[model samples]
Target: MEKNYFNLLQLPVVLPIDGSLLSLHYQQLQRQFHPDNYATAPDNEKAAILQQSASINAAYQTLKDPIKAAEYRLSLEGININEEQQTIHDSPFLMEQFMLREQLDDLEHAQNWDELTLFYDEMIERKNQIYAQLLEYINQSHWLMAKQQLYKLRYYAKLIEQIELLQEKQFNL
Candidate 1:
């Protein structure tokens, strides 16, 4: 049986989880189950400790990021979010994405920090709005709506990363 990351991490299985508490639990688990502590154990026990350590690391990583945590939550509800196969057919949403991408492309070529900063702020606001919607959907068990919002969140996240990378490159130059 697959492990439920929330249960493993002693989390509440909710979106917008308490990140600080998650980290604390992860650290405590690591200290307790780290294979280094079992150095003198029998071979079978060492192997089991290794597996437990690996599971703790995996659970920590999955819960540390909101996107991954949300995806895991959906999976727990028997709803798989397959970005590759899911086609976002909402016309308004598609149009907004096209417009945002166009703006980002223009900003990338221009490399104007002022404009890029403004764009980044706008993207963050939009992403936050989507996140709020996603939170509500998840709380209400509106799985399909939450999935759709997650798709949009992925786009904004990538776009934000692009802006940050551009900023970093400019800083280096």
Candidate 2:
């Protein structure tokens, strides 16, 4: 069985957690076990704090991201959402992504920021809708649908990352 990150972080097993709560919990754990706080302690104590701090950081990252949290929960439920032999057979979703990529590729040099911002806003709205459906699936204990949405969300996340990199490159020019 997989270890429960929610328990490790002292958080409830729920999607759409309050970001501030996660941050607060992480900060509290960090302050308690940060190596700097054990500077004057023995070497063994420092090593222990370092290990604990690393574990806390891993738990924090898992809890803070909705997708990672979903993945962890699904894994615990005995569902492997791993893409080993799995393929996204959703044709409509793939087509939509293709069209979005087309738009991104066709972006002109002029007015790039405004155009990219509008496209990013559209992507954000769709991503939020995906998240809502993912939460509903989770709340209802529908692991299959949640897994499907999680896959889609991961794809969107990668594309959005590319968009952000493009923006950074343009901004730096």
For every model shown, what is its TM-score relative to the native structure?
Answer: 0.95, 0.85
Query: Residue-wise lDDT of candidate 1 within 1-173, one digit each (tens)?
Result: 86688988888887788989999999999999988899999999999989988998998898898888888888898888975688765889889988988988898788778999999999999989988898899999999988988888888898889888888987898
Regions of model 2 farther than 4 Å from truth: 1-3, 36-48, 108-112
Task: lDDT for model 2, please.
Answer: 0.83
Please provide, for model 2 over 41-156, each residue's C-alpha lDDT reduced to its tens digit, 9 standing for 90 to 100: 99988898898888889988877888888888788788898859766779999999999888887763454788998888888788888988988998999999989988888888
The lDDT values for all models are 0.88, 0.83
Best by lDDT: 1
* Runs off by more than 4 Å, candidate 1: none
